[model samples]
Target: MAKRIIKAETVQITYREAIRKAICEAMHQDERVFLMGEDVGRYGGCYAVTKGLLKEFGPERIRDTPLSESGFTGAGIGAAIGGMRPIVELMTVNFSLLAMDQILNNAATIRHMSGNQFGVPLVIRMATGAGRQLAAQHSHSLEGWYAHIPGIKVLAPATLEDARGMLWTALDDPDPVLIFENVMLYNMEGELPANAGPVNIEKAAIRREGRDISLITYGGSLWKTLEAAEALAREGIKAEVIDLRTLRPLDDTTIIASVAKTRRAVIVDEGWRSGSLASEIVTRIVEQAFWRLDGPIARVCSEEVPIPYPQHLEQAAIPQAEKVVAAAKNLLSK
Candidate 1:
């Protein structure tokens, strides 16, 4: 069969509105799909992404679970196994830790553990990254931790198109998928194709094409990297920005090709530096394109500290545009 088309004429909308549209479309297309999470029903989503979905889908489909992450998450897993496609929402990445048993132990291992007889066609959506001054407890970027797992698919939708399209694809996958939406991107407004639909979740997309250096990132860090690229352009340095939309699969092909062309790289990640997704990407670049490199790979990551509540400290704690520019410049100068 020919591949499905998900794009059409273009229109402008906010990032959160795109997400809400995606969920609404998915539910309308398939009755098997339903949404469950804290404040998802009458209260709307914690970030207000689901503000009007409750009335549209009703209490049955738009479930409002108690504040028990583990319990509701596990219930979602069970419901998935019973032939229902459930979208379970965790308020934040930090709060997702409470559901680790159900996610890591069960959702990520069920297919292999059950000899491929059982599949978890579930989607777990949660907010990630820092910028809201929610403190350490509420603002953690643990998408990297989920990416470390083997079976479950990890996705970070950084752009309006991905926000509008990824959910339907995730719902179609046989295995479990975790979508990490950067809380800061919710209000971001942009124009998207009116016919936008499910996009391929297996590859990275180069937001900007350049030859001097490759700035690789995903989710919240994407826009920052793009800004840094613009700054580098002003200084006569062209930088390529790659958005690794799928974290677990790590789209090594796109990453390697970019590094092979640019010959230098700077990874920007919102997670802490040590043993983070940025570290993993750097290692991959070294292993796959070491001979093509003109300089040592560098990374711009969050400082090794709990995200502080104070605005200045929190800004310091995470990767930003200036830091990415500096890292790229350093790589090019080397």
Candidate 2:
């Protein structure tokens, strides 16, 4: 019997499935690449994004580590420094905190500390964002926090193409790379071209073009921002939607260009508003493109509170299209 394989030839697929296919393709292409994490093997991963990979690749490569994020993540870093490509999966963004020292102190500083004598070609994937009523400890969008650091790249794949394409490109990078998959986007249905493969991890993509204002966002908040753009369009306001695909090395050119053109910007981020990626972008706009602005910049971010477990509270705490729309309108009025 001919072996059946995953394929996405202009067919509808979920964000989760696209990621699994990317892992499969990468493993097939590079013998040095391997996946390691809690429940990543027999348990098919915490979110099942690595399902069937264990059977296809075997235990040697599909390692299921104990509940020690720091231990496994450190091991993955060592493997990378030893010339092997390792994909370390931290079950949730919250859990990554356990490995902070390993990630920030070692993986992020190895090359610099060693004076370019070493490189950590490692990729760390984790589920992020507040949704599904996971409560404070289990949920939060901290990708923006990691973007604060230097020597590492941060990527947020908001669409099917990115879910399928960004992994390999990140793996190809010489330093550590972190990929944050919004938990809410796993079930999202989308299409990817059959030939879709590695995508650029260096710049932002303008999802929609407009002249009224720029709706800047990334990850789970991107969809809400896009919906707000559509709503604004119907109300005679053309809002450009910019998806900051790669959070770190933040594609400042794309953001400054969009804000300079629209003359207004509303940053919609699932992370907290205080000192967030949104704030960084806004500060950059003010510093670099202040003259192009026609109105004050606004931000629609998660309310300043630990994400609530109740569905209503959770939804209200995070950025929504309605909030984005209101912010845009208020900016336009100002």
Candidate 3:
């Protein structure tokens, strides 16, 4: 009898670097994986995540698409249907609306409409949330919009581990996955677990445990929620922070369990109050844990207005640390 040895491998890197690593590794693993978007090739991406990728992968796989969002978006869908794994970067989710037909109509509905004969193996990455003064047009949280679609998997990678690992999982999935990377979280540094490989796109992860309140949030708002939780700790308030990595297939079990213990929840979302992800989450709580509640559910969401350009006003427009704390306190009082 002969014995065979099996070995595991992994790497550690920053959030931005992790994204590049996953893309490069996935491309190396499969020839079908290709990237297309404005400035993704020659300019090295707007946020520099795909920097130097074009030089290594060449222009064919590392395509520099034109500014026509709708046209190139449709092209990406067509390429995906033609047996290619196309990663389309929309620059920002706000601009993705221009290509809604290509995404929602084609990429998201193809497999179901075809009677499960075909799967749209497409990955769409975009910078989302309100910050950096990009204002109303460039900065908007559209994850809810993508999550609303049936065939798409919407992911919000709030940590470096998920940032590196989710891409692989999303690419491997047999349907379209939208990866939203908050602009403020790109530079955040954290240790990547040695065994961190592919993360599930359908489950939520509890980042911190507490029994007083559940600070639920995802993407850019995660940091702010954590900050608010830290402050609450000083005043002897316990907060269980939940990082909702995926919005579409939301982990209701984790959320419901936390809310059941705390009997209170404050959802922090960087989107407008009305018709936002926060609203949907609150609704879920009402449906699942209405009897378990100790007080009325509360939400700390962005003001219902265009994101202001001024730094101070911009801070006021979105959910900040203080805002989250206040919301949590208000809920606790009720």
lDDT string, candidate 1, 223-332, tens digits: 99999999999999999999999998889999999999999999999988899999999999999999999989998899999999999999999999999888887777
User: How far in Å is the alpha carbon of 321 misplaced in model 1?
Assistant: 0.9
Provide the global lDDT of candidate 3 against the true structure: 0.89
TM-score of 3: 0.94
* lDDT to native, each model: 0.95, 0.94, 0.89
The parts of candidate 1 lying over 4 Å away from their true place are 1-8
What is candidate 3's lDDT per residue for 245-299, written digit by digit as tens?
9998889999999999999999998878899888999999999999999998888
Candidate 3 clash pair list = none
Deviation from native of the Cα of residue 18 in model 1, angstroms: 0.5
RMSD for each model, in Å, please? 4.2, 4.3, 4.5
How does candidate 2 fare on TM-score? 0.97
lDDT of 2 by residue, 196-309 (tens): 899999989999999989999999999989999999989999999999999998899999999889999999999999999999999999999999999799999999999999
Q: How many angstroms is residue 158 displaced in model 3 relative to the true structure, after the best TM-score fit?
A: 0.4
Q: Candidate 3: how large is its RMSD?
A: 4.5
TM-score of each: 0.97, 0.97, 0.94
